[model samples]
Target: MDNEFYNAFASPISVTQNALLKNETGTTQKPPKLMDIDDYNGWSERFGNWVEAYHLDAWDHTEVQYFRPLGSDRKPIPIRELSDEEKKKYKNEKLMVSLLQ
Candidate 1:
């Protein structure tokens, strides 16, 4: 599913911490969402002009990225410390007691 999603979008649109309100004084803004654009081809052409105007790359450039795989209510998965010998003797991993039983 993850692979299929990535292949389709070729990019992941992360939820912004703070949405842009307006272009008021001393207010910075992120680019608009794909759905926000009414015209794809027209926007792409204009976007190319924008990139050139700002001296930016025509292609999408990604840097350090992080993704949350679980819901906000979901508890984080725990990691256990292992000894050197224990690390060397890795075995099949069991997730939960129900699965194990």
Candidate 2:
């Protein structure tokens, strides 16, 4: 009875200690803000490639029901090439929507 109570209390304390010391099973933790624009662009490019290869079957922009994405006004917009002004909004971004016909 005493051993069970002791273990129940000690288990949580050990977990808290591990988290505080950042020593949870040899896993490395890094802050999210450490990534810059280049890193984001690179990852986005890679992700876009994967999506193109795997998720290309459903890349229609005409039918909003397929993609189900919304614009600022909560309305579906056709996925056309962004103008210079619109491109400015995503200046640092890379590998945006896959170019489709």
Candidate 3:
């Protein structure tokens, strides 16, 4: 009983530790940052390649349009009620926005 309790508690701590440490596994070089209009062309090409290297399906995420599920009354349906595909798109949209920032 004690072993089970300790394992359950330790699992999350170990996972968090691994997540924090995983950054060291990658190259020290970071993806290109957009500085200004003069650098936009170079930055866009480099950043697009960088994003593609890291995320194979990233372009799909960029191209998809998210249409909110609407109820009969025309109000948006609750997010919790979204279909699995919609939920994935919703999550990807937030991720893309974060990356753009």
Candidate 4:
């Protein structure tokens, strides 16, 4: 894997380790800053490519289901049907960023 990609993937673990070290030293450490969805686009693309390369149709299906959550009644709704603002917010969430990375 690319070093940049590896570093990005390892960042969270590093932060967690730092936090633990600080705690052991009786120091308080602030929480890590979150990344928005735009920050995750590259990672998402990479993951999608990896999945395609592996010939995993399951990953493709999971990706589709991810953007479109099942309704309370278990009905599927297209993610694009969301309002512009909602879409923007979802795209920028940390969960998406982490998963993408």
Find the candidate with the highest TM-score and give its number: 3
Tell me the tens digit of each residue's lDDT in model 4 across 1-101. Answer: 69888897578889898766553332222212223456455545655555455434434445554354567788865667777765654554534344333
Model 1, 59-87: lDDT tens digits are: 22212122223336675322344444333
Per-prediction tally of clashes: 0, 0, 0, 1
Error of 4 at 41 (Å): 0.8
Worst 10 residues of 4 by lDDT: 25-34
- Better by lDDT, candidate 2 or 1: 2
**TM-scores of all candidate predictions against the true structure:** 0.23, 0.24, 0.59, 0.24
Q: Please list the residue runs of candidate 4 whose C-alpha ends up more than 4 Å from where it truly belongs after superposition.
A: 1-38, 63-101
Q: Lowest-scoring 10 consecutive residues by lDDT in candidate 3?
A: 21-30
Best by lDDT: 3
lDDT-wise, the better of 1 and 4 is 4
- Against the reference, the lDDT scores of all candidates come to 0.33, 0.43, 0.67, 0.50
Ranking by TM-score: 3, 4, 2, 1
* C-alpha-based local distance difference test score of model 1: 0.33
Candidate 3: regions farther than 4 A off:
1-31, 56-58
Q: Clashing pairs in model 2?
A: none
Q: Answer with 2 or 4, whichever has the higher lDDT.
A: 4
The list of candidate 1 runs beyond 4 A from truth reads 1-33, 36-38, 57-101
Error of 3 at 19 (Å): 22
lDDT against true structure, model 4? 0.50
- The weakest ten consecutive residues by lDDT in model 1 span 91-100
